[model samples]
Target chain A: MLSEFDLIKQYFARPAAARAQADARIGLGIGDDCALLNPSPGMQMAISSDMLVSGRHFFPDADPTMLGHKCLAVNLSDLAAMGAKPLAFTLALSLPEAKAEWLQPFSAGLLALADQHNCTLIGGDTTKGPLNICITIFGEIPPGQALRRDAAQVGDDIWVSGTLGDARLALAGYWKEHPELLRMDEAQHRQAALRMHRPTPRIELGIALRGIAHAALDISDGLMGDLGHILERSGVGACLDVDALPAGPILGTQIQDIRRRYTLAGGDDYEICFTAPAAKRAEVLAAGAASNTAVTRIGSIEAGSAVRLVDAGGQPVELQLQSFDHFTSA
Target chain B: MLSEFDLIKQYFARPAAARAQADARIGLGIGDDCALLNPSPGMQMAISSDMLVSGRHFFPDADPTMLGHKCLAVNLSDLAAMGAKPLAFTLALSLPEAKAEWLQPFSAGLLALADQHNCTLIGGDTTKGPLNICITIFGEIPPGQALRRDAAQVGDDIWVSGTLGDARLALAGYWKEHPELLRMDEAQHRQAALRMHRPTPRIELGIALRGIAHAALDISDGLMGDLGHILERSGVGACLDVDALPAGPILGTQIQDIRRRYTLAGGDDYEICFTAPAAKRAEVLAAGAASNTAVTRIGSIEAGSAVRLVDAGGQPVELQLQSFDHFTSA
Candidate 1:
């Protein structure tokens, strides 16, 4: 029964004491027409936005807390890919109705991740409609130091942080699209579902790899599709080792064909993929270790404009592995 | 049907020449994990976000071009209220489907206004879902010069730019809700609809009033409700002269009671309401004149925490005028 203003004030607006602590770089927080941010003098602001719709992006009855976490986490992943430190974010939410039962856990999940990264929620808008959450995040990075897709070198080694394909494997189980292909125990299913729901933005790994990596991006729409961005932008190609891709524990137990498909073409992985000079392999490993994340070399950049997929024997492995396209895919 | 990436590249992505001209402060734009913004050395970045849903914010079959324009215009109004110069914006759109027919004019309308304000569309996300458009805008202003809502002082004269109530009048006509109280000819109805659909953000007026105005905010919800934000933030009250309000040309011809109701409580008015010292009246008028916007004094900030409404003769008027609340309003 709360009005929009009352709902915003009750749920989203931070108290003065908390606001002051959370808003070191924020000149103004909520309750203003526009929030003001004072970026550090020599730093460039890195910005990205992501929108999640209820039925399209997640189940209509998905856990509100995880939904909130995933929304901000995706945007934070972009900042992580750019090697930018999180600063602040603005959320615009459209909901069918305002209910405390949903909002309380949602905000709690969102703010928890925000607090973990020292990111402030400066301002946002809330309205009544079909449930949609859009977040635009801001981060700071030293000028000329951001990891860019165009900077990939042809001889660089392609690396991925953490594991991939578990989220997609979890999604396969949930949707039952390939029931015969994907089989998982209850414990494995729960673990994979957690990956799909609660993605950790590799902020520390990105920051640590700042000058070590040449180009980087977060993998949301599978490894092949997302790494293609780096290849396309850098005017280069890559020779990916299908057998070398680091798969999640659960996915690693799957058949080789299923494992390759899920790891190479999975969506919602939220893991960073980067290219580093072969000379810096040790440095890259050190950076990953420093950030407490596992890094695996999956491929090597090539000269021609064709992504060549190869198995351990170096024979070309051909497969129709199209990445997830929101409109074209089911 | 275009894939998500192709849709973005075809419609929303700017050509290199256009991008070069638009992105002066942008280091990295579209095709990156995150866009990089190089803020001016001494300026603070002002940020605001707005979301519009299909049925809640507009008619389901509304003109796509105008809808695009209005979506960006509302966010621009926030920058105008803060006396910040527009720099860039990120759009996150959720659409039921990607049709070139809808996207063509929509991007044109959006980019046209952005070009007018020299605001670049640096980065965004597009997905399939119920129609929703969320834009987060960035602007820049010199440190300590932003027009904040909490800066209003007692005895300051409150002034408004442009006119009010035509948008709400158009809504009434379209909805036929109170047909007895509202009447309009075809031309008048078109004019009112234009007011509702194509609001011009007072960016110039706000920039000109940077040092002249004490507190400022754009009137979106209604004068009574939005101005209440300034009063509540500043810990002051106001004495409003209802007769002195500048109603839209069409609303000006309405009955006294109708004009009072609509002018005082109409939503979707993007004009700015600001407070300034009585001694700066000449400077305020010069600022308005320089911006080519009409400015009228409508009230005076008072010491007490109550907003009093009165007529030209200083006789108090009693009216139950509540501002539009999205969740609670019809």
Candidate 2:
């Protein structure tokens, strides 16, 4: 078992690369009873929380380190939706029991992401349960400048950052407990599984999009499903272009068979999906470039109040929207 | 099972009583998907998170509403310890199954306390897991005004707010699953049961203690145990007046049988254990009185290496230092 001191040092006390991009006034990161960060001037703090349960969010045997990473990633995604710059986070970890070796690697993974994102571990709680991890993240955005799901405007272009479906394909092909194709080199499988375990939250893209994007949300529950949130709240609709979507190579190869199902249904890709006005397209692209972030235009807003799929020829296509719904039939 | 909408509306949407003395930045309370708050000028936000799980923090059959209240209350205690004014909080609730009846009352209880304390609900995650509720709260304090556990000085006067041991007594007498008691109306038993279920956090008093209390922490664990944390971190010991110690009526009744075990081992009862100087006693009392909060002098910080509980005759009592340790066997 890992000692409490060592567990913190290994997992949580570390930093991520983008941390250098964090705003000044962050006094300490991880290893303290609480983390301290000085709020940026003229900014209001935004906070969001998430919980991942073993056997629900992941398989029981998923690596603990990756579990740690994914936990922080989900909360970061929430901050992204608010167009808030990541600052710090607190974790509430409940395990069936404390095991030192498990904690060491888990903390390492969690700290690694925190270091990469420049997010400090501010405070946490530990207890006994069926291995549940809840993370609450803190970020800041200029007041009234926050990107919201209700702000999508008519005549806006819909966009998503990064390729989708890789996580879903990995889950179906690589991480399955019983694989039909005993495939993808074990190391490659580990990497694919790592993606499933630790998704990169688009904090930079989110912050950059604040003044550019009209409405934004992090794509945790597949593009179609999460984008539905914007349409619902904004009282608008979208015409998603199937051909314009940034697809994982695996999805492309399986497109003839899987029919882009994973891209439409897979939920773990922690990317940001947003809408920008036609007039601000250049500014949006410029902000993306300035932040060294990659973003792709995928769709357009519609005056009609229904989401539809458009084929490459701009014809509506029939497709299954198998998005993640906690209450939907399993 | 509780529907998501009703659960949110009934439990989480309620607001606290008007605090004209409180800050005016809580622009919106708990009705919307995300709460909006105005940031106070020159203040930095402090955050903390804690999770309570059934079979870990309480019995599985514990009143779900009280369980919900306790989870949010504890996180509020963290903010109190920092001398921050309550602003907003996010709740991540995981349940094995969805039950609308359970959710409505549970959210009602949470909203009741939130309304009284003026903390808004911004955003949170709700999913399926073994019954656990994780609350992450945010508050703001003036720059460098947040009190912490590590700031105790040797000359400070040790003080505790409210009485203790009622929680221990409630757990022992009211929490036990007695079929005969369950069959009876048992109003007194039920109220006692509430203390064991929902422990109120001291937010108002904590804010008042901002510049007055030198160092402070919420006594979630028993006085001896939590104070030991201050002593260990501050590198000093204490001399507690056993007779002056406030145990309320329950502990007084139980100390005769269990020999003061109730006072020494009770958990929950989110009260503040703090240290100030002799010169500030009247100020501290006035602060509590102004807030309808009670505080008592229980001990004094001393130049010593260990804690010594002195009796009314000024003789040292050889009592074993016992308190709750979550990791250790009960």
Candidate 3:
């Protein structure tokens, strides 16, 4: 079995990716207890952290490789929500026992995703426990350009990228329970698992939307509950058009129902949810195009104080709204 | 009892400490789900992480408050070993169940230490599991002045600070077993426990020794074992004067007779061990004095292949050193 040190050197350590961006002054990365990063003058850096516990966030017996990818991906999502460009990250791994096979594939998956996103695994601690991985990501953004959660304004249009409910369906063990999900062969199952394993961090899209987004947040808490943060913080109300939502094709009829609230209140979509003025709609779409990311207008902001969703019939759709609270258990 | 949100607001949020020499730009400190840092131009930021798990790093019933303190302290120790100044930190907290009383004091202790050191608890994740606390710390230094374990050279002087072996002894509950060990004072028992609880991170002392020290590391796994890390990495050997080691006063004549061996191999001191040239000995002492942090010379770097302990009689100390391994239990 390869030791932790060997695992890191084989997988996590990589040469400079694209020369550390001119603005990013990373003098040293990988091979040390810590990575060093230098940002340009007057630019503010953002840091965020998330912990994924086995059995709590993923299946206890889930693939270790996927666990590693998901850990870094979730942390990158937090940085994206703040319009921060990825720089580096740290991991703290807790496991019940050390298994060489698990560690090898896990490190490979983590390092691959990290390289793709231009994030370096700077430092971490490994200890024995009930399999918990905590990741803290560091990123940089120009001063004053960060899109805050409290900046949403009345009359702003809400937008989300990509289709929702796919990760949710995948989490339901759909691919594991039904062999039809394997229609595209082993590669297809792997791809679907990849989406569930390593969702892309929309950092480029976020950086492009810096000035365009009035209020922005990651779609980790479903749409309604997360959008509620914008409404509550901005002291405004929202009118979510159920029909305009970008639910995946799996939810054919319920797409416009507004009551089946997985996409609305189910968590872990990791998509960016932003609000902008109707006049800047074209600009927002252009920004997404420039970043090669998608954008779909799903709702509009209003002057009232509550977030209300309207079904296809233009009638208020009153659905029980909640979020995936870390402290509150199922 | 306050909810998680309220607890975070009441304790973790604080103003960033502005430093002229520190390169880590912590703009937004301890609010939202992440902290914001803006690095100074031409300066690089160093980061490190450490995780402490129940029944692994500490006793399962360890005080929650002290656990928080030690978690952050160990990570800061890494920054200190690298000659970096800590700017901010993120904590990933996992618990078997939600207990307001436990979390409140735990957060308070963590925030107290962070505020004292000018580092803020920026962001963290809280979940349900066997208790584990992982802290990731951000520190800053000049682009290339970081004292690293791989930089030690032969013919340099070795130094350590404070004393060692209290934590290891306390681990066996030996101090509690013998009333005479603590001068029979009940408070002494608590003091020993406190040492195991809140370890002081040697940041100031480390930063002060910046230019003088060639290589440095924290004495986490004992003087001999941790110092061996530097020698092994630097491809040098070390000869320690076992009689010159610094040991706590708790041990009696019997333990003191072999204090050199235990101090050489005991772990969890959190003190720093560094190498410097004998020519700059006065300057190093003056620097430690200026900061009011004691520095004691212990041994010397030698042109050899491995670490060795020499007694007063010029004979090698015969003992098998045992250090804690994060991956496996003995």
Number of the predicted model whose TM-score against the real structure is largest: 1
Best by lDDT: 1
Local distance difference test values of all predictions, in order: 0.92, 0.72, 0.74
Model 1: how far is A322 from its true place, Å? 2.3
**Each candidate structure's count of clashing pairs:** 0, 23, 3
- For model 2, how does the per-residue alpha-carbon lDDT over B1-330 read when each residue is reduced to its tens digit? 454444554555433313312546654333222344567777777777778888878888767677667777888888887788777788888887777777767777787787777777766777877888888787777877777776788878998888776776666665553433222235544555566677777788988988899888888877788788788768888998777777755455443424355555577867888999889989999989976888988888887658888876889877765676554533
Greater DockQ among 1 and 3 belongs to 1
- TM-score, chain B only, every model? 0.98, 0.86, 0.88
Q: Each model's TM-score? A: 0.98, 0.89, 0.90
Q: RMSDs, each prediction?
A: 1.3, 4.3, 4.0
Residue-level error in angstroms, candidate 1, position A124:
0.9
Q: What is the DockQ of the complex in model 1? A: 0.91
DockQ of each: 0.91, 0.45, 0.60
lDDT of 3: 0.74
Which candidate, 1 or 2, has the higher lDDT? 1
State in Å the error of residue A36, model 3.
Answer: 2.0
Better of 1 and 3 by lDDT: 1
Give per-residue CA lDDT, model 1, range B135-212, as digits (tens).
Answer: 999999998999999999999999999999999889888888777877688799889989999999999999999999
